[model samples]
Target: MKRTWFTHPEPLDTTTANELIQRYTSRQIQTKKTLAFDPKFWLVSALLPEYRHEPKPSKQYQNSIWSQ
Candidate 1:
């Protein structure tokens, strides 16, 4: 089967683009388990903003070090 990739026109920094690509790649890998074909996964992702690229504190720890 033919495969196609789509990207938005909004300029993405290298980090943001890499994160988005990783998300898409993982989704594609998970699709292999599905019994039926679905395009909604990719569609929804495309519509959503790439917010995952931002650096955030780890949930496992607090910012005590930085608070000093």
Candidate 2:
């Protein structure tokens, strides 16, 4: 954890890490059913990038309303 992006005031020991993971896992269990069956979920996200080609933004795009 040395030279990482974030600096924690906390000392992250094994027990604290396990507790954090359990909290996250509990949240996912509550939301998993809804996200898994949604049409605009991971499947479309994964496939769209492969099948669709998008134009790269030019310098002019910086001032365009679309950028906003």
lDDT of each: 0.44, 0.35
* TM per candidate: 0.34, 0.27
Off by over 4 Å in 1: 1-5, 29-68
Clashes within 3 Å, all models in order: 0, 0
Which model scores highest in lDDT?
1
The TM-score, computed over Cα atoms with residue i paired to residue i, of candidate 2 is 0.27
Please give the distance, in angstroms, between residue 57's alpha carbon in candidate 1 and its true position after superposition. 34
Clashing pairs in 2: none
Give model 1 RMSD, 1 decimal: 13.1
